[model samples]
Target chain A: MIEWLAARAGWPARWLLALLALIMLAGVVILAASIGEMPIPLSVTLASITNGLGITDLPLDRIQQGIVWQYRMSRALMAASCGAGLALCGTILQALLRNALAEPYVLGISAGASTGAVTVLLLGLGGGLIGMPMGAFLGALAAFALVILLAAGARSSTTRVILAGVAAAQLFNALTAWVVSTSANAEQSRSIMFWLLGSLGGVRWPDVGLAASIVILGGLICLCFARTLDAFAFGEDAAAALGVAVAPVRLILLTVTALITATMVSIVGAVGFVGLVIPHAARFLIGPGHLRLLPASVLIGANFMVLADILSRIIVPQQVLPIGVVTALFGAPAFALILYRARPST
Target chain B: MSLEGHELRWMKHQTPIVDDVTLTVQPHETLGLLGPNGSGKSSLLQLLASLRTPDTGRVRLGDMPLRHQSRRRIARRLALVEQHATTEADLCVEEVVQLGRTPHRGPLRPWQPEDERIIRQVLERVGLAGMRRRRWHTLSGGERQRVQLARAMAQQPEVLLLDEPTNHLDIQHQLDLLALIRRLALTSVIALHDLNLAAMFCDRLIVMHRGQLVAEGTPATVLTPALIHEVYGVTAVVERSPHHGRLQVHYLPDLPPA
Candidate 1:
């Protein structure tokens, strides 16, 4: 495997690996879509997606088509893109911040998004999930501003940034709890808590469109800065000495990752662990080079999320588990094991 | 071309750390910045390297001010090896060395064969010829220092600034590193704690006392017993060594400077 990734083969091999990942993701998507109640046939599921995508014309009943394309397919795509965006954010954050444990939400975007989402849900600000993402976007940007402002006094060190993020997370968590406890009764608060845990139960075409644009744009921007991010793998001084405009570039990349991560949280309600663990998992398979690790993390995260969502839907039969719970359940242990093994044992 | 500082002053928490330091190094000369801990040697070196901007003074490379040159331009011409620099993650020696070529490449430019050749040559020059794939955390303290030196050399710099590069090295590696720095075809400013080593390795030595350049000249003239006692707060005897015909300093045990 190392020989295959060696520079003797280089970019062509990377592209080939990416192509294989893409093919596997497509296979997973079709398979995951066909796993719901009523058991849509794989052939019909493929036909429905291809037809919905306008690739081909096929005979299909209206209800089955709706179930396959409108419901299952849309949810799967949202999971894929959200996963990609979150994983990409995590990868960039880990490198730029010079910390392996730095996750997508390390800058407090998810906490802020949760605050915005809870506010909208309790007070009926946007009346539904529609305005929730808007609130999340605004709150994410605001919380990020606060983190930067709080950390600015500390000389922009990584420890300071993470600490500021933790502080912001606590502040926003308080606000979320206050809103939910005050405005929402027991039934409404239960739904609010479930949403906070993250759910993809009601995903539709608009959610996919909204998330895909940012994920693709953000991923492209990250790709352009892959070499700069690689420079950061050493440290800030080394990166600056290598001609990276340290101050501005770090601020821009942090904001860029926040933008993508905020959108993902709004869509998926703060899906956990994909952002924290998938990047490290990808790094283990491929070495720490951002050029390869960035793309590998995206593909692997997408696949992992799609599978998790499928399991969430099918686990208890008519009682869907929140996707966040599923990820946290599996992701936390996997991450701990990886961390234990990766570090030198002194 | 010369690297010069004009009235360089730096302050931390309302206290001056580098106090009005003005110095210059001729092209291809080895100038040692010798001072004790917190005596402003690192601060002054950082000011000269363009890594840290002074509060009241400016650094000039040739006719241009340090700020006038773009960071890429400065990086191409100047390289600094920090005293305690370490990678946050495990990277192979080759990967670490290849990062030195970053200033020369950009978004569109790919890594070239010439960069590869330079990396190979520097690795061999540093006596790490077959250790390209060695992990950073696995290397000894001395090997890490040599890796840093190789990285600086790969920058193709016109001027190099090193802060305590030999701090953790064995005696042999320390001597070898200084000799290599002297032989390199560039101007160098190295900070050293060992006055005798600095005297032997440096073409000229600048002694700092209380954030001031107390003396500057050839090692033989600058490293007098009185100056060493004054700056470093230790009674020392300075004499010419017959073996190398340069100034050698021997500190009196438990004796304080008067």
Candidate 2:
């Protein structure tokens, strides 16, 4: 349906699609905030949010209002931001690396960030001088640098890059496991394992602020390079021939991806599959033009994550499954579908 | 505008791929580069395009050093259609051609009437006007090459560099493409394999053997039985075709090496 509209209408169709996606995202976010441990009505949730923002005052139960305003709202917003950021990274990586499977989780960025966060938690690296996000950022860079180094000689080969990423993910995951097993007590290990599985239970307003700001900033920077990324459709040499400053643009964009991935990993642990699958879905719906693909991925990813979070909360009897578990459960089958669809015609 | 490469040398893993190659393409001239396999024609074309920095020499665009100009600035005046250039992205033909306009447009600039006009004109010129919306993966090899040519034409470059663009093309397209290049009269350096096509289309010809320029002149002067044997290790009889009034080469079976 969207393809027909976009093809028929051109410029106006993009705006309409974007508007539709934004509305869908808003609806899912509201749905997420309303359906939780304590069921709150949609009207009360809206009133509570508006009241919290000093936009409107309405009578509401204090506990329900507090749950919606303080806990569910922040968690929902953070999920949206995290989803947008991850999907954006996936889109950029797939373009630059020219591989459909390239994403933060698959490329080892998330695993590296998990290692860094675990180091901060158990080993007390930096003596609390550096925060978890900073540590994760450094580790993400380290893993990325390692992958690039290993993949340097075969830089044009996408398969070699993915292999190098597999190597980095194994090495960092081992490091994370070693730290936790060696240093943590039973209770600490349990908590660390839970965090590693991606829990959004503890996210608050501050986390939401950080995630939203980084995602917005990163999305904007990526938008500015949309045309440059398009030039890379053929390859690096092709991009250079088309007047893209390949090296600097690559460095800046990779750094931004690492930063965004690290922030999300540090906050909510390594949520897999969204980054890998959302971009493909967005491309399928909107085509491969980065100008539209980037925004479409962001909005779709936001909605997908919020919906995933909602499912994570409600799927069990009085228990919350990890967000990563829910995402992977859905994303794995979707990934298979994408791969099946992508098979070359005989 | 003239494109000149001065003493260009590029090495990969300590082995020279393009060695001390110096050449020039005059304005409105189609210069054909001929070579056997592994003769460094592709590398030399890249060096001339400034896509790869020469190890020890410089390329000049017009009178200015190519290294001094921004990539965007160079792209506006020069374009390269790389051999076997393709993408995994599911881009339609028109979208792929629009990529040619990158150097001419900016991020904030909306698509203009001129840009659309150029795209349409190039598509029409390349004979893919009706297939604008065709997905790339659905196209045949020959169609893909023509689409790439259309893209290069959309760049509006004064100096065009193409590497074996006729590789996958049919015989008709090969002739048509060369004739089109001739008609455009743009400063072009084309790496071609067919000696007859080079002789028929190019104003001048240069031949490479083992990363060195071994022959350079008009095709009539540069192409000879001795040069062909020495460079390509092939026995051939070179004669002017009466039908086309151009040199045509007839190859003989290889004599057993003694």
Per-candidate DockQ versus the true complex?
Answer: 0.52, 0.63
Report the CAPRI category for model 2. medium
lDDT of 1 by residue, A83-166 (tens): 898899889877876766667565677888888877876688866656877788777877877887988732366667778888
Identify the candidate with maximal lDDT. 2
Report the lDDT of model 1 for residue A293.
84
Mind sharing the TM-score for model 1?
Answer: 0.94
State the TM-score for model 2: 0.97
| Candidate 2 lDDT over residue span A239-320, tens digit each | 9888888888999999999999999999999998999899998888888999989999999999999999999999996899
lDDT of each: 0.83, 0.90
Model 2 RMSD, rounded to 1 decimal = 2.0
Report the C-alpha lDDT of model 2 over B1-258, residue by residue, as the tens digit: 999999999999999999999998899999999999999999999899898899999999998799867999999889999888768799899999999999998975888999999999999988899999999989987788888888888889999999998897889989988887787789999999999999999999999999999999999999999999999888999999999999999988856887
List runs of model 1 lying over 4 Å from the truth.
Answer: A1-10, A120-131, A145-164, A338-346, B255-258
Which stretches of candidate 2 lie above 4 Å from their native place? A343-346, B254-258
User: After TM-score superposition, what is the CA distance of residue A69 in candidate 2 from its true location, in Å?
Assistant: 1.1
On TM-score, the leading prediction is 2
